[model samples]
Target: MKKIILGSLFLCASTAYADRVDNVQTEGVLSSQITMTVADITCHINQGLGISQQIHIPTISTNDLRTGNTKSVEVPLMVDCQASNDQPGSIAIHLVPAGVSTVSGDHTITTSLDSVGLELAWKDTSLPALIIGNTEFTPAQATNNVWDLSLIARPVLLAGKNVTEGNYNASLAIKVTYY
Candidate 1:
């Protein structure tokens, strides 16, 4: 009887150990893919200037619109670029409206105020007016991989539309591509 009891206890212990082993998970796989962008040049907005820039346009009067004179503010944008080698990379920048476009017939971008819009151009007038979302302005390198791109913004009234007086706001995005 003693021998039989001892043998049964051993059998029960073996069964419990087998069940524990079966419940254990033994295998798994983890995977990840890495991708890199290869470019000869990289450009960034100057740290001090930051990515967002605000141009303050002084108040405009209806009489001012009747005449050709309007207040224009200078927007100075500084960009820093680095080339992988001695050869400088080509950089092109374009402006895009951040929100819905209200482009008027005169090629001016409409602001929040009705009939009121803005016109953008390079400070160096020889470069020509910057057509919103259409023209890419190529900036000359003022120094070693540094660009002092200056632009001008002015408020104008559309023809036949009455101006609404209130605060007006508009946003523009500067997109840069390097090759």
Candidate 2:
């Protein structure tokens, strides 16, 4: 009988200990997402023109001691930065004749730009003239992205008793760069 009581007590203690034992549990959940997009770049020429009158020197004679005449030709070139990513910091433009990639003439000419207000002359004997200008996008500085540059090419007809009678044909080209 004593053994039976001891066994019963031991069993009760074991059962109590088992009940006190706790079942621990842990869990975690993680999630994430990502996305992206891209686009292509492009450029185009909006408008360009020569803002000077086409001169017609009918006849030049030897007795005429006066020098050649000068005409102001304004080459107005416009570029639309609306299509560009941002406003261009600066721009450079070069003018070349249609057939000739370089300037070759008899007389020296002076040219400049009114926007940036810069002037330069041709030092070389082969080239006719060199012109430069500065432009800004601001309304106060420059109204539009467009730059209107003026160049002066003085045509000095050779002084002699008998000069040729024919049409003197010449061409001009303008190149632009944006940064």
Query: For each predicted model, how many residue pairs clash, with residues at least 3 apart or on different chains?
Result: 0, 2
lDDT of each: 0.67, 0.39
Candidate 1 lDDT tens digits, 61-158: 77786574798888777667644343234556677666644656433677887777777777756254555444443435546667666677788887
Residue 77 lDDT in model 2? 42
What TM-score against the true fold does each predicted structure earn?
0.63, 0.39
lDDT of 2 by residue, 25-111 (tens): 346676777674343323345342332335333343423313333332333344544455555555555554443222333222212
In candidate 1, the residue pairs with backbone N, CA or C atoms under 3 Å apart (3 or more residues apart, or in different chains) clash, namely none
